[model samples]
Target: MNKPEAASIGLVKRARALAPLLAEEADEIERTRRLTPKVVSALIKNGLYKSLLPKNIGGFESPPMVFMEMLEEIAKADASTAWCVGQCSVVGMTAAYLDADVAHQVFGKPDDIAAWGAIAHAVQAVPGGYTITARWDFASGMRQANWLGAHVQVLEADGTTRMRPNGTPEIRTILFPASSATTHDMWNVIGLCGTGTDSYSVENLFIPDSHAALRDDFSALREKGPLYGITTYSMFGLGFGAVSLGVARATLDAAIDLARKKHSVGIAAMKDNSAVQGLIGRTEAKLRAARAYHFSTAANAWQEILNTGKLSEQGRAAIRLSATYTIHQSAEVVETAYHMAGATAVFKSNPFERRFRDMHTIAQQIQARDNHFEDVGKMILTNSVIPRGPTM
Candidate 1:
């Protein structure tokens, strides 16, 4: 409706302010796979989680690059915290695209409210609502969310999925309040302990029609405003990919610093070791290249959205594929940095060790690295293979 305060709040400046708080308790995050209450409170007070939503909701509605830049800063401080916040904030973006009434019902509670969940797991079709019996692992930020949005398929009375007029079944996302769902404590892992990305479920949860919405309807979004014209899920990919790139970039920076001070056993110091120098140099180069590819695609897409108002299905897929490639490439670079960190890092006291684990987890972020190669492979043959668009 009205211009938000996004222009006034410099995204980088706010990220710089939060880095110390995030770094101060990196160990705390490592221990819990979730951020400490203090860190969570600081994020809220700083308005860090609302960066993706429009300023009308007290958020920044910052440019896509802001997500990339800020995530790198946060990743530098604590990867797990960055991971959780990234996922949480993106969910808020997705919710903002729903019907205003639906948006309000879920994100309506308070100015600082956040919603969490994934669109990955598939739900079965049935009357009233889909019989959601899928295990959605890695539900980062689930611990702090007041609401969760899950993917579903419309079904007929006979338990068959209902097909649209185009002979395609409509896939929907259901927004369920946190109170109605049960959380599974399955997040114990080697990294990102503070993410609390445990399993959650809603057995036969009859989510009312209003809380659930489709992504394909354009007329509805036009009636609302320009904000809805932007694809919420694509924005999520931008934010999450930004998190991956940031962690990789931070890992490279940390390794280089460590190299400058320490020396190899035979050599004067790690900085003098040609081997270490090469490793760090290569890591830095790779991270930059990967980031350039990611941000450039995202920037162009956002600019296009501002100009043309919406993206073609192919355009959205291209951006998504770009993020997938970025995440995969960045993880490879971070792994190289981890190698430069050496055996001392395994002692657990080394900051580099925690980051190594964090970056590895970043690769496993469902939509990014781990799934990228396969998705892209599937996409190459999309015409004769995986059907494109929201249907697939």
Candidate 2:
């Protein structure tokens, strides 16, 4: 196998090796509403956070399939950890688009971590760079990051919004030291709380031009690797969909275990019941189907990039379809497993409750939204999606 292939296998092994520790720390993570320092340190030590970073930056830069598999393995132990890893790893992909000096400054160290949130505010243009007083929310894994990024619309010095050549508002992701911002405790949620997906704000912080990049723009690409050809957005979808599958697999397995050991007073043993058997069979089938489709889509997309050095519009649509469909299907499998566990599923001591909540939470994220189906369907129907060069 090639060096990349070998590196991919090694990373997945590392992730699997860390699973038991994640499972052990799961409760503490939930209680603290963030990953325990032990878990964070372990992940850092393993270099799992740099899974999607460019190889030139001392990262593994593993294939999309390997990325998904590693996240899935971690998710089987702790979905929040998987979510945080998935988010931060994809954020690292931005390094490929940035200037080499700036990229190294931001993500150079072994333990360096960077986190960012959705686009919300605009940064004011200046001669050297941009100045921004803005707050960004939903920054997952922010607690441990030493660097932070903000995706913002560009406001020109003359009080006009900068526009891309395509006529859309110009957006740039500005990277700054995490110490420059005020971190907030805003990640209170029903599930995936261990991610520490908090909010933060910076007041008139000046970011040099070198510290920013037009994310996912073809023209802005600085690192020309086949892995960089895939869009960050699609990588997020693929990774999170894998997380859902892991959660579903674990939940279903727990349900199966409960069925084997628990028996009601009146009804027959759950494992012996024909109905329970059928449900287990069907749920397993569905979970496997979803996983298969998810991996196949990712593999096909990666293969396309390798063959043609670009991802086609059809490939992008296929990715969206597979990710959304797998997320929804995994949720169904989790629901079925939770229901099968009966009273046991409701108890916090059992695995079902948390996994159930986590599964639903994954289902509700932007990656799993039902509208993705409509979007991809529209694209497929039109056949007018101009095949762009490798771009988001």
Candidate 3:
């Protein structure tokens, strides 16, 4: 393999090596409602923030598969850490669409930048830029992120919606210094709490035109690598799916360990029980099948992009389908393990308990929502293209 390929492989190993340390700090991370400074430092030291950034900007720009692999390994230790990493990595891809100098200035120091936010509301176009007045929620990694992005519908100076040729309101994601926005301490959640996915608000924040970029705008992209060819939303689906798979894997292993030692009043060890044995087998099969399907679909799309310099609509649809299916199946595997653990799974001290919560939370994310299935189905059945939105 070439140098880039070898470097990618090494990065995967590096991510795996961090798992033990992450697992050790999982409780602290959840309690703090954010990654500790030490954990954040570790991620920066390993260059994870630059995983998807262009190599020209001192980033790895690794293939999507490599990115997924690294996420899976990190998630195995703590889903929140993996989720934070996934969010930062995906946002880092925006650099490819930015002006060369601007991209360098904003993303040059990967260790100093971590961007996260939601797409909601609109920004009114002003003379030189836009005036932003919105509150974006679920801004994962916000606490540690030095930068934040807000996806907004562009409104004309007269407050009319700016329209594109496709009849959709033109939208752009505006980046700002994190200090410009006030964060609300509202990340209390049942799972993935360590992600620090709180609500943030900006009032009349003026961002220059150069600070915003049209998300997924192919024509505006400066880096023409195949990695940039994969739409941003599609990349999120893939990476989040990998995180679900990792969580399921870790939970299953915990169940197996419990079964080996725990004995009931009327039964021998749980491992010897035929029903428990069957549950484990079925869960393993489901997890493996889902993982295989997701990775295979991702690999095919990557290869197609490499060959054609772009991903076909069908390929994008397949990615949506596979990621949705993988996430749902992963939830099922986690549920099965949690159930089989019986009373043991209820205690917070047990690994199965937290993972169970994390799995369900993963299922609730936009990428894992069942609505994606319907979107993909409509595309396949009606021969329509996948609609460009969060569902993609």
Candidate 4:
């Protein structure tokens, strides 16, 4: 895919400038067990929070690559901010797959701020629409969000759950009023503490016929634009993968600083060890590879959209795999940096430890690097199709 013109060099400068502020708020966010309103407001005002928002709605509507670059910077400063914003941006992209009317209602509001979660455990059926009931876990960004998309399995009119072509129950993702759901203050986790990825329960919440959109049938969407191209879904992998990469980058940088000054009992300085130097070189190489792969894949699919106005299924899968590869490897790179940081990484207050914790959480993400590998394998080896479910 052809690469779009590079983002203005000025964005890199701006992202660098915001790093200190993000770092300063790390402690406060941890103390509250959620990102404070102050941090959210600051990020939004700085344009960092909506990096992936559509251009029509006063956003940069940046390419997936640009957003990925920014995420690395944000994670270097604070993994929580990267995590929160990445989650929000992807929800905005999902808006493209919905009916045009639904998309309009979602982004239609001047103050619309969206978040998404999947209630895979909750399933119920109604006449025209469906009833969703369950506690969505790890619904990041819900604290500051105005709306959320919850994934559900559809139940048919005959009281039987709808089934996919594979005969597994077919599922749908429904957009729900964020306020209609009640949040439970149950987000007590060691990593990603500030994400407020709490348990939120919606009891018998009835969604109208319009708000439900089946991801598997994105073509049925009435909203047709360059954004509808499969590359848009690449943002899911692009944005979050960058977050992990950023955390890993920060961990390495911090470790290098610590290594330069410390003198072990037997060694004159940690940096003097050839092994440590080799690890640093390895970390740099992995980071560069992640950046290249991410941009190349986003460029591939987006270039097709700009030229032909559409991307085929094969192209979409490649971008998805690219995202997964970049993010998953990024975790390994960061863990390498952590190992070089020595035993000090075990302390909770240490930035190295926090980054390690945050990077490890990437494995738990719904679109995890491991799952992406599995999906790609399925696509290649058999007549098997991409698993269509509430969650992509």
Candidate 5:
């Protein structure tokens, strides 16, 4: 194996080593509605924050699969931590598109970079840069992030929309200091609450040209690595899918432990119960199959980019398909395990309860929507071009 591959394996081992500590702090994280400073420090100290960054900038620049594996290990301990890590890592990858000096200024220090937010605002062109006035919601990890990014539609100096050749308004992601934006405490949800995915807004925030990156403009990319060829959307699908998988695995383990010890009024013991036995067997199969499919598709896509310097549409579609399927299947496994655990699963004191909630929330994410299956199917069936959207 190559040196990078070996290094990635070591990183994954390190992530696994942190699982016990992350699990120990999961309750406190949930109570705070954000990752505890200690948890964040552990991730930073372990070099997980730079999993997707370019090597030139003191990042590991590990392959997508290695990044996903590390995320899975973290998620197995705490889904919220995994979700936040995934956001930070993927956002860090954007550094490769930035100018060297700007990248250094924003991401030079591992603790200084944390870009997590959506972009649905308008940016007006100014002399040296753009003026942004808008609000972005679901800014995960915002509480700990020193920097944040928002996607915006570029407007002309006169306040008219700037159109590209395709007649679509030019869109770019603008980066700014997190302190410059006003954050709203609005992340109350059923699960993954520790992500602190609140809403934040900036009024007339001036972002210099150096702080903006053209949205998915591969031609403008400064890094020629294979990881950069994988679209951010695809990475989200894979990373989030891995998170779901980890949650499912944790849920299954919890249920099995419960089964071995508990005996309901009717059943002699959960272990000896025929129905429980069958459910366990089936759920394991489903989870393993989904995991294999996801990793295989991701690895194949990564290989294609490495060999050819570009990923084909079919490869992208396969990745979308596998990720979507894995997430949904993982949810099913968790649900089945929760059901088998009976009353124990419904209690907050049990591991099954939180994991059950987290698994469902993961499915609710845009990346896990079932529509991706239809989109991939249409592309494969009709052999026509599929318009890129959030899921793809």
Candidate 6:
């Protein structure tokens, strides 16, 4: 892959520098079920939120690998913050598909962040644009966002569901101010509590035509950059996969630290135990291998985009495979670390418990599901083209 620009390197450094603050605020973030204003302010101050925005529109449009590395670094400090950043960063990519004037109007501001979730209700396409009265769930990072988006199936004036050329229902993501929607406090969960992954409702909200964009549609893309060539969902897979790796890395490091200082009742110090040493060595190898697989896949796919100006079918499949595999592998490493930490892993005060919970939650997300392997396997078996879109 090509070298990342200076701005991209700066962003990664800023992410790393924010780690101590994120670690300090992790508990508060979880208690409040949202990022603190200070934390959000720091993120905005660092310009970390615009990691994937087009540079032409006062955005970074950072290299994909650089974006992944930044998220991984942040995830090491706080998975929820990293998760929220991942969600918002990818959501911001919608700017690439919107008209230049409209995109600038929506995302030109420094603090403009958007978050949306599972497509639920159909939106009526009006003469001017569309009117939506729908409720979406699992909108992460909405608590701190200035804008919210709804991915809905477009219904024509005749009350028919609009169809795309490929026979699927036409879906467009409509962006609107967060103030226009009623946010629900429904983010009760055991892990990644700081993400504030909650449900929200917008009633009879009128979205102008300029606010809607066909996400991940290459033909509809307005930006001309290799980064825009990749789909948003692919970026999510890469990012959240990195987040899982960060959680795994932190968990393992904690375990290693504990081993050196911790002692059992009847046995020697964990660090002195040959078995423990061997386990550490093996888990380290496992994590390194997973990280290698993940980054190498991303780098290869990025090189493809740089060379061909688009991500190929195989590139997408390989990314899905590597990302999903890395997430699962990372979870395994976290499990090993948590297990090695033994009873100490259960306490909230210690690092192992939250990371254990966060790792499992990451595995539960759509990007880490087992079915992704099946999808890629089918493609490999038939050598047939898979349907391309944000969801695929």
- Scored by lDDT, the top model is 6
- Ranking according to lDDT, highest score first: 6, 2, 3, 5, 4, 1
Per-prediction TM-score to the true structure, in the order listed: 0.85, 0.96, 0.95, 0.83, 0.95, 0.96
- lDDT per residue (tens digit) for residues 1-392 in model 3: 77876786677898999988898899999999899888899898998878888889988888888999999999999999999999988998999988989888788985756566778999889989989888989888888888899788998878799988899988898999898989899988999989999999999999999988998888889998789999888899899999999999999999999999998887688888898898899889999999988888888888888998878888888898988899999999999999988999999898998899998999998888778788788776887764332322
Write one digit per residue (lDDT tens) for candidate 6, span 318-389.
889988999999999999999999999999999999898888999999999899999898886797764332
lDDT of 5 at 27: 95
Backbone clashes in model 2: 0
TM-score of 4: 0.83
Name the lDDT value of residue 190 in candidate 2.
Answer: 92
Tens digits of per-residue lDDT for model 4, 164-245: 7778776676788788888888878768888887767788888887887776455554545566555435667767877877
Model 3 error, position 297 (Å): 0.8
Q: Where is model 2 more than 4 Å wrong at Cα? A: 384-392
C-alpha lDDT of candidate 4 relative to the true structure: 0.71
RMSD of each: 4.9, 3.0, 3.3, 5.2, 3.2, 3.4
Q: Is candidate 1 or candidate 4 better by lDDT?
A: 4
Clashing pairs in 4: 1-300
Question: Which pairs of residues have clashing backbones in candidate 6?
Answer: none
lDDT score, candidate 3:
0.88
Evaluate model 2: give its lDDT: 0.89
Per-model lDDT: 0.69, 0.89, 0.88, 0.71, 0.86, 0.90
Query: Which window of ten consecutive residues has the lowest lDDT sum in model 3?
Result: 383-392
Q: For residues 321-381, could you state the per-residue lDDT of candidate 1 as single tens digits? A: 8778777887787788777777756767776677777767766765574455566576676
| Predicted structure 5: lDDT | 0.86
Candidate 5: where is the Cα deviation over 4 Å? 384-392
Query: Model 5: per-residue lDDT, tens digit, 1-392?
Result: 88766876777998999998998999999999999989999988888888888877878888888988999999999999999989888998888789988888888896866765775878889999998778889888888899999878988988799887888888787889999999999988999989999999888789999998987678779888888988787888899999999999999989889989997677589899898889899999999988888887888888788998877777778878888989999999999899888887898878988898888998999988889988987886896653332332
